[model samples]
Target: MRDSFHHRLDVLVLQLARMCDLTAVAMSRATDSLATGDARLAEGVVADDVIVNQTRTRIEQDAQTLLALQSPVARDLRVIVTVLRSAEHVERMGDLAHHVALAVLRRHPDPVLPAPLRSRFQLMGSIAVRMAGTTGKVVRERDPVLVRTLDAADAEMNELHRSLFQVIGHRWAFGIPAAVDASLLSRYYERFADHAVAVAARTAFIETGTPALI
Candidate 1:
């Protein structure tokens, strides 16, 4: 019985890690769709979001079952609880990617980003994707040190996000519509990084018992 219960716990952790991987792929493809205005890729990213959502649901269900049946305490309880919270953050990351893809679809043949702002948004997306990849490792290993790296990544993303406003406010001649779209898209990438950071923070809390605000 103990062995079977332990196996279930392992499965939950693995599922959470796998979910992170899925979100990373989503973000990458979404980024590509945004940069190139690929409607088909954008649609695919939007469709795959259901899979990400389903993964989160499965993780939550399995973790809850373990909580009820195994009566886990101490580190085991910490792992399960943190897994649920991490799953939430990771899933949100997926949603942000989906939002980015939807923006691409909304714009259709017209490019979503202006010429000046395209590189910035692309960099932000890259940071988000990197954070998601690292988050998977953190989820599986629960390493506090690895979480710190994600923290650094989130900071970079924030800087890039702020830079987007600088362009739109002064230099942008793309008019209000384009500016608004850029602002929202920048927010999406920023939030994507934020969610990745939050997931890593949860992994850190598993070890250090620190509650991260972001």
Candidate 2:
């Protein structure tokens, strides 16, 4: 029974990694759609979100089963609890990606981001993708060093988010709609990075039993 429990735990980690991968892909494609005015790619991101949701459900059920059947204690229990929480964070990241795609779909051929803001949004997208990829590594390796990097990455995202406001504050030719989209898009990317940091922090806590502050 103990061996079986460990096996399930291993499976749980693999499942979480899979979720991270899907979320990363979604973030990447959604950004591409926004940058290029590709409605189809944006639609694809929206459609694929169902897979992320299903994976989260599987991770949750597996963690719950481990808790109920194995009665994990100490680090084992922490691992299960952390997995449950991290799954939610991952799911929320997926939703943020979906929101980005929806913005693209809503705007269609006419790019949601203003021409001047395109490069900034692209940079934000790149950072978000990098963060999502690192999140997968953190979940699998649970390295304190990698976990710390996530906090820095999230800080970068916040800085970029602030820059978006600065851009909006200046003379804007794209009008109110563009400003609104830019604000929401910036927020989505920031939130996506935030969730990635949350997942990394939870993984660190599970490994070291020390809660990470960002």
Candidate 3:
């Protein structure tokens, strides 16, 4: 019974890792769709979000079952609890990515980002992708070192987010609609990175018993 419980716990972790990978890919593709104005790619991100949601539900149910049946103690208990919270963050990341893609889908042939801001949005997307990748690594490895690195990555995201505001502050040629879109785009990416950082922080807490400062 003990071995069975451990095996189930390992499976739960694997499921969480899989969810991270899916979320990361969704963000990458959503960003690409945004940059290129590809409706098909944007649709793909929207469709795949169902999978992310289902996975989150499964993880939650499994965690609850483990708690009821196995009554995990100590680190095992921490792992189950952390997985529940991390899954929530990961799912939210997917939703944010979906919103980015939805903007592209709404605009269709027209680019969501104005020409002047395309490069900025591209950089924001790149940073978001990197953060998502780092999140997956943190989940799988649970290395405290990698967890600490999320702070630096999140800082870069903040800087990029602020730059978007600066672009909007000056007399913008893109007008109010474009400015609104740009603001929404920036928020989506920023929130995406924030969730990734949260996942890393949760992993750090699980491993070290010290909560991340955020």
Question: Number of the top candidate by lDDT?
Answer: 2
Candidate 2 C-alpha lDDT tens digits along 17-136: 779888999999999999999999999999999999999998999899889988889998998998998999999999999999999998877879877888888888889999998999
Q: List the residue pairs that clash in candidate 1.
A: none
Residue 97's lDDT in candidate 3: 94
Q: Tell me the whole-model lDDT of each prediction, alpha carbons only.
A: 0.88, 0.90, 0.88
Clashes of each: 0, 0, 0
Worst 10 residues of 3 by lDDT: 205-214
Please report how far candidate 1 places residue 108 from its true position, in Å. 0.4
C-alpha lDDT of candidate 3 relative to the true structure:
0.88
Where model 2 places Cα greater than 4 Å from the true spot, the runs are none
**Per-residue lDDT of candidate 1, residues 1-214 (tens digit):** 5698788888888999899999999999999998999999999999999999999999999998888988999878988998987888888999999999999999899998877777887788888888899999998887878888887888898888897778777866888989999889889998988888888887777777666666
Rank candidates, lDDT, best first.
2, 3, 1
Clashes of 3: 0
Candidate 2: the clashing residue pairs are none
TM-score of 3: 0.96
Give stretches of model 1 more than 4 Å off.
none
Residue 104 error, candidate 1, Å: 0.2
